[model samples]
Target: MEGLVKKLNRRNFIRVSAIAGGGFVLGFNFLSSCSPEQRPGQLIDLNAFVKIDTNGEITIMNPNPEVGQGVKTALPILVAEELDVDWKDIRVEQAGLDTNKYTRQVAGGSGSVRESWESFRKVGATARQMLINAAAMGWAVSADTCHTENGMVVHKKSGKKAKYGELVERAATLDVPQEVNLKSNAAFKLIGKRIANVDNQAIVTGQFKYGIDTKREGMLYATIIRPPAFGQLLESLDDTAARKSPGVKQVLKFENKIAVLGQSTWEVLQGAKMVKAEWKDDGILESTTDYSKNLKSVLLNEPKEESRRKDGNVLEAFSSAAKVVELDFEAPFLAHNTMEPMNFFAHVKKDSAELYGPIQTPERTRTRIAELLGIPEEKIAIMMTRMGGGFGRRLMSDFVEEAATVSKLAGNIPVNVIWSRESDMSGGFYRPMYSYKYKAAVDNDNKLIAWHHHSVGVGSSAASGDSFPAGAVANFQVDTEEYKSPVSTAPWRAPTHNFIGFSEQSFIDEIAHKIGKDPVAFRLEMLEQAKNNPIGKVNYNPDRFATVIKKAAEVAEWGKKKAGNVFQGFAAHFSFETYVAEVAELEKQADGKLKLKKIYCVADCGTVVNLSGAETQLEGGIIDGIGHAMYAELTLTKGKPDQTNFNTYRMIRMREVPEVEVHFIQNNEKPTGLGEPGLPPAGPALANAVFAASGVRLKTQPFIKSGLFA
Candidate 1:
């Protein structure tokens, strides 16, 4: 059995024995120095992420959630490379939620690599230094003469070598180094290599456990029957038939919804369907309808939050311009459509509770659970599982809260709340629908003069107002109009940039067309302005953005002809601290339809870690962007979503996937975000390509509805 074997108060260090396979656990709590403030019996410290056992096997704890973004594999690679351990000899374990120990345990904004890169490398370097010190002491040689390679310390003068396992006992006695040396990029062995995911075998063999697969002893299944439309209040409920259903355990009513519990998921689903309920409309339908029309009206008349960005005389620029281009773009709300739906398992007692699920922000989940159950924050334990897909969907913990509430009401019998496919799809909290009106002025020489834009949406939480061209253009102004809706919304994928990139890039392409300039060359000129001329404050690196744009164009043969009737569209954007450019190739089919033939993408996120993982993320992001831009749409009718499941809500099919080529700029700069940067350029590039082929510019998303794809 494992135990808390050691507690060294000198440095606030603690150890647990026999982890994974009889290895010692080490952790440091800097807060331990401030007593009285630091709670008793609780050691809130950054725990040791690397462990070594007697057999020379190692375990690396991954502190962030793995929502198919490949952080599960990429972060651990940093640890193994710095520790000088062979990739084959190490295993990765998903760390339990402990915000104090793993300070930035949450995963969002594509920051997993950027945030953990240095600290995790330091963790490995520190452990490696301790092992080398122990080996040098054992060999009676100078520590400087001892070098580490492949998890072993070698003494050059005496030709003595010791495995890390042999030095673990001695290493634990050494003081933690204040600063340890980290290897240069050239010395990395595992970081940049093409390494398979540590859990690939388990995944392929169907042994991987996701949040939906979480189970416990005496666990009950639950299904929530919520209102069909937003702002609807439950008027009455009839759970008599549900309670008599087969395998039905209990039916409970909440303030806004009803929950049906059973011994199995199928029974819970059946029971939920049987419990009839009526809801009163809370004026949601009267306030919102015909999303596009309402948004346009709001943009014209509603009071707006105007962004503070003025560089030149915008009124004079537009009045004296040789030409002006105006376009309006709209996109509908989008659902995440996570394959594993929303689910969580909660077992709450009087003073403590344990929640296990796939949560992107476990800290938020813990806090919400505590507030809902009236338990202390420390009493809640959150265990994260492998997620099927997050795409910014799991960032919110509403499902976890429901499970905790149901568990409390069910006498703390371990309850697992599962959202049905319909409920998951129809439920609110989606990517906010948005509309944009852009007006641009250009001189006779085809140089851009001024830019004005107004955006209307339900909320401006994520990426709504921060358009990229703000600093790139000399005179730019932005305004946003908001429409209050009971339908909840949150960030989806790249947040506001996802849709803004499509609209903004597409509009820029249109301006280029009106001026009889190549789209790629026009964008290049803009980047050069941000690079050389004086802009207010360019948030993106002009050199990096231009590099990716040039690289993507070079790779895709920007203006060159292909074998068939193919045309190319190019777009570039910076988001999440990373720069990416993409080009989509469209072929005119014989049936008057545009076939996506191929795509080329180039990214510069700095210091590549796990080349294979980064490429996978880029490919996934590009495809996701293409799917949402081409076919995905969620419309509201009478305050109710029109689509529920995949049948009504479409997605990009495998048959529609084009040949994708991904490239990354090589550099030693700190790695930035990868999971989201590739996505922002995909939609605009695709739409631009379609226009080049058909001369029909798409001013709205979901080309299917816009009649461009059709």
Candidate 2:
């Protein structure tokens, strides 16, 4: 029984947990599609979908959404492990926009595998159990005596065996295992090993489809024209020219917006540009520089709400401080810049509404659409497609609403509302621009004393003005002076952490340099302080924090350096229960530009499920941080984003790609997040290096320093 239980849990295979005499089973499809009718487009033909046919070919319905994050490969590897099938014999198919079998789509937050880890295993394990039980009942043997291996249950005592494929029909009728035993880390044959992305073949072959590649029969493509400035309404419009344009279906004008509904994407693009509409500028709105300057002014005068740490008298500590280092930092707004942009396909009829697009939170989006359309949530079907890149972009349902509204406008015809690169840029859900004022001090013996950091920034887009100030920082005292824009805001990967990464860590770097201590050593000292004696009441895990920092130092040769122009700075951060530490090496090029030669990041994110996928995230996240550190900035000159696309809104390119080395700390603990933790450390490490290289205390962000730009 123990052997079978261990086996059952190890692969998320079938269980006799709730079954009587003869047991039951379920596979990947069974779990992902517990109730087939509920899933939007469940597979009717089980042959091509996941099934154990006569020959025991373990077929799997490859969950849609080819997220570059490696879920397409990592998720199936989880299922294949649980199913106990020869991985070489597994068959995969793109689960069509089917909500029944593939609900809760739009993969982000590094959740595809971890969130569905046990559940997907249950699906595969249950199916295998059912197969084994059926074979046992047929052979008149006790199910306990028969154990499954490589898709066959062998009656070890009698040396009798039967293939799982020979009992598919009977297996499908068995009940699912409610309670499943998961495999120990030691028994894992596939997980934690390097598994290549499953969709690489389809993507390389041009067979993989993103939302931009989505095409439907008789589906009209459309483009929208929103007010250029928030609080600005279109006073007038001219549609005559657009109506005459080739393949243009209709020109739509509603309140402050316009849409060029057309037959193809090109026609919509051309028509929308031709159908010119003028808008009076809403001068009352705030521009980038205006907001920055005003926010800085307001934060100094205004007192903020408090919900975080505060212990021994900060005022008294500051008053008696022998030395104090105080500085302010600012960061511009950021665009998600997802290559596919925000687009959705919606077909709403009287009976039901069917939708397909790229979304990170399909469950949440479905509920939002149901409320807006006044349709029952059950009747609203959602399908997810491969995201070009989310970066926390698709979490917004505004695009989904836009599609539904357009579909209703097109006389309930299936409408695919697509936003161009400019639309994506101007549509305006941005990484909120922020400012930080920090003051840190040290006493006579160079012992760190009081540290005070005041944070200011735009609120969460998902929560709007309703969020951010509530619990954005620890010891967080945030003063939110609402800079309301018609331009919406939403979650950009790591939320306020992006700005805090710049503000807190960079300020810490300044403090590190003043105290004449290694930046890594300084943060570790804080972690030590935070652990041995915390300042106030906050939910911070200092042990993990110290572990990551110490581990990072070990891997990066944090203290030892032979000597070269390459100046190294190290930083570590803990967020979302994951710990990451980064060491960056930088030197001045002959051209006066900074050259990032290498970055070594050691992460303790608990158990690493897929080595290749986690490493990719580490690499991508590091580069993402580098891009924001070195070049990426969203400046506002005239109440509109200045850097609209990649041309001005530059991302780190291949040549600028730093040599990144990632090492994961192995442990028996369950996995935590690997997505956003590494991001917080890059800016501080790089900034510290800049100081070491130039002998200039680089205190403020837009790290190049305005004088350098000038």
Candidate 3:
């Protein structure tokens, strides 16, 4: 029976619990599409996601990692609103990975809010309906006469009211409500309202605990010495000196690296520095400082290429064009540099294991640790901690694997692995460096007729032309050439959009300048064409895209002069089912350096769950984008990362961040991604603004800050 319960399809998974004193606890499988029989404590399952205690307090579980994206607060607001419960009456709790009960717990690609919207609403509404039914049963009245408000059920004419705590017992007896009514958009109170983050007070007071703060009784700290470069392995290690270091407990050598365990983190750090290891190159990759040259070589002579998208006749359109604009753009690899670095705690035993850490993909973490420790997935328990930052870095469980391996090798005692700042930065899994070639054709009348884009990288897609300006042009072609590398890479923030948005929008701005039109007007013209006579199946809504573009321009007062030598640049993009437009304002200093003055962002993500949180995400993304464009890059030599710490890898200083204003389009469209959509356009807008202020066409990334205004 337990095995069957664990194997039940997502839809068939349901859990119910009775409170000690009075109320009922219900765990709604938001991902479940089918209804199953309600089982209360007969089979094993996870604790409930939604619980009503005997005191009428509501506890809602947020399945996704907070990762500083505010899903912790935003998702619970979603449930509380639909449940018709007062927001203040609900306490949000972080849920651990439980594949049998909670699927889709991973947080990446700005999908946490977008994916959980419908199901969480259902979870809340279903619980509310159950409470209403329970009240209706207890009052001996038709359920139709009962409605829920402020955590209580009211009988309209009978003048009888019952708290949720008093009605839970009856609710438990009733069958689970298969269908429940959802609140109308106009009725949403807690969702759209600006509510403070649940952890804001804790965060401000330095009482909030992150993965770095995790500790256990008798836990040993382990520090690893990995290869300085990729394609290298440890040939020999002399850890005898390390074991003799102060507070050093043990020194273990592995196939690829060495680990030093000590009584304290300080001891582990000192002991790790004392260990000596020699690495032998595998000869898989050679040392190189020029990524741009390598990327261009791949694009020029790649034997195989894929045309991601093609429409009309690109060659013929270019041949008949009165003018052609062509350019090349490249962006370097980027490190995640999460605030807390990568750390995890594990206690692996022969039959079972316990793990805790800050990770975005928790279920995958459990599965991978199980495979590594040779334990049943069910026997391995994973506890999630607050992450200082994710930005897609925590999506990988390599840190967890290291901790589990250390624990297993050390007699299955609890081990906490902590990566130093240098180690975390040098560790691979960076944002892949990418390069692109863009060609645009315009007639004598300045009407765009053709577009061609070729991108080269390990993760580059040939179909980038399919993003924006796809259906807007009659002739569009995108070709992709891939280059394999020994270095590891993964999605960073908006992934491809992070670089694609800058290249595409910057080229569009160049075309608009040559055609003697305002940048904003040029995009609006293309959006108009896409709306009226699109060349192909346009995946985006033309109206929404155009709306945000126009709104951003209006708010920024495009073409209007501000105080001092300020210039404005405009760009817009659509990604993750959301539309965003940004206008960046720049001021030139007396010394010919550029200073960001302000940024205006307008978004159409559809029915924002938390307005304040949404705005903060946009603001953060804009600054992050600016920081990367101005000073962030990861170079490689011999398949190894060059940047090792914040000293070398630049971050946006507090003073460097500019004032930002955010506005959202109001509609009932389902909420889309907020984390990434705002990021893609920021780079282009800032680049365009740099051109406006400095009269330099910045084609490369990290913008060569010193030469920008030379």
Candidate 4:
């Protein structure tokens, strides 16, 4: 029997069809816009699906990328919750990227669950209503009297019950409901509960396939030799030895790189090593010292551009202040260092291309490939794999484009390009190096009256002018300068907030100590002023920000006296529309060394979809942030990255990770972002804790460089 389909609006549609062996297949188009005239079979834009078998088996398709952020499990739970099905009865599958069907399919910005919360719920609730309506017709009762519970439709008065699978044919014949009532927060059975990640079993068993594991029939492995330095161009190439290498099939040159294709990864790498290439410096060869000096020069002597934000006169306030504090902070570039590295498989045919990989932005990648290959966008198919790690590296499609380019250039054959650890490290696109110069003024009463912030960075500005302490102070000004470097930079995790949070919060902590007030209390006071009486526009919600700060302080015993060796530090930040506060507990060892004891984190990301996933995100973000802030730094030596691999690139060791306790403010407020908000506060909290313990302040990232943490 053919299924019934209905158009809910210009952007959404629902269709129900009968499965071959007596079941129901429900498909929902939640993103793409289509006309009513589009037939159900003709509309291939359905992004989400729910299927039921005669045995009452259930299946759900998750449409977002899974980058260890738990959206793979959390999004499907939204559908399962409203479907009123047993969690064990449902099977989840990852959906490939379909540009015509899904919007916002990329996994960056921590927006998967937050953006799809309401629509995913409607998908399941609408399907449940259809099933209830089908059962009601069979029982000769009103649809309103039929209720669903645990995948069963029941008639309350008549006491007739039918499994959803049994009513598939009837449900398939009914019109799709325009709207369905969603379960209230208290009625949610699976959302807030702690459920294991859907891929846990696969991962633990080593059955999960990452992008690097992709293999296709007769596909050749490729390794590309790229420029050695940031401002270098390929000058010469000799590929005779590379082409004659064992298992090598082809050696091709594209732009400034040489591609070596072979039967295996090892063979391709060997072939690439045999190729002789010469590079010439095309621009200035800059070093880390150059970046620092240039930025400091701009911060000290350059004329400032129009202020990003300004309230009262900052100069006047500073001139009349009883005391003023000035401090300089610096952070170096950082690599994404994803576990899987960069790899993509592409089969570029005459009219179409098939691509498979773990790319964060599939639509954008497809568009770029289409433009490069001179093919229609629809001819390109991208299947996103479960990424071992993305952070923000996969957001760039350079690797995917390389695969497509190699495949097309090598006689239109299938090719899988994989980057070695060194290649991945030196391939550029790192987090920009940043420097902040802050000046604060206080009156005789120790009341902070003015705030002036000047920041300089490579590529882009890392300043959020309207963030916290903006409207709290009477006189505030923020301006930034960008240094045009020959290095590439992209968003890394929380982007600007990652380092800015540390600089701003550490400065706030310093100011609090200078004024003889508790760090937490001082932050709360500023938040109170921003909430009640503000100096300018306040971008963040002061109340929510204050709540997380108070919670973290209370949970960590912020101001409570500790052992003679233990010290605590507090920091709070607002980013990605979520508020987070963290307290770092440190122990001063007998040898004058310090060790991180534990971290207490409190967040207000609104409703938690999956308790386990939410907690895991918070923990992961904290660990990642702490690791980067404490040890990770990517520097340049004559336009070449000084650290190319794990040996040179210092990473926080496992033993160095401290215990983390995560708490969430449970509310029905719309979910914001959880993946990144937890990160921005961790670094500053740890820095503050170090200062409290040693009475020595850290003004630079990779605190080990100070020879204190070492």
The sequence of per-residue lDDT tens digits that candidate 1 reaches over residues 1-710 is: 22111222445544555556554555544344322232222212233377788678788888788998898898888778878998988888999888655664777888778766665676677778888888888878878898998989999888888888888877877776655678888778888889998889999999988889888989999999998988788999988999999999999987698999999999999888899898899874732346677788876763456564667767788999999999988878899999999999999998999999899988877888888899999989999998988888899988998999999898888999999999998874789888788889998888998988877777653233335676777787777666677888887998888988898899999999999999888888988888788468777887888899899999998887788888899999888779999999988888778888888999999988999999999999999999988999888778788899999999999999888999999988878888898898999999999889888989887887766554
Which residue pairs come into collision in candidate 1? none
Q: Name the weakest run of 10 consecutive residues (lDDT summed) in model 2.
A: 461-470
lDDT tens digits by residue: candidate 2, 1-710: 12123222233233222233232323333332332232222112111124456555565765645556776666667677766777677776556445544545545555455455555665665566667778788889987788778777789988888777667656656554445555677777777888777667878999988777778888999899987665577888999999899999988876478988889999989988787777787667677767778768856864445523454555677788788988877777788888778898999888689999787667678788888778988888877787888887877778888888788777888889999898798765888777667676677876677666555566531111212111222232323344455556776876666666656666677777787887777777766766666645435567766787788788777767636656777766665557788888886666666677889898888878789889988888888887777777777655566776778777767987889999988887656667676787787777767767776655555665434321
**Model 3 alpha-carbon drift over 4 Å, by segment:** 1-13, 30-48, 284-288, 458-465, 704-706
TM-scores of all predicted structures: 0.94, 0.87, 0.94, 0.95
TM-score of 2: 0.87
Best by lDDT: 4
Where does model 4 exceed 4 Å of error? Answer: 1-11, 19-24, 29-47, 302-304
lDDT of 4 by residue, 517-579 (tens): 888889888888888998878888888888998899899987789867799988898987799
Candidate 1's C-alpha lDDT?
0.82
- The lDDT values for all models are 0.82, 0.68, 0.82, 0.86
Model 3 over residues 1-710: C-alpha lDDT tens digits?
A: 01011122335436566667666666655334432222331111122367887678889987777899998898888778877888888898888877766765777877777766666776677788888998887778998888888989999898898888887777877887655677878877798889999999999999988877778898999988989997788888888888899999989876587889988889999999988888888876544445577778866753366577889998999999999999888888889988898999999988999989899888878888877777899999888888898888898988899999999998889999999999999974888888888899999999999998888875445235459999999999888776676677887898788889999999999999888988999999999999999987698999999999989988988987787888988889998889999999888888888778889999999988988899999999998888898889888777777789998898888988889999999998878888878888988998999888877778877875557532
- Provide the global lDDT of candidate 4 against the true structure: 0.86
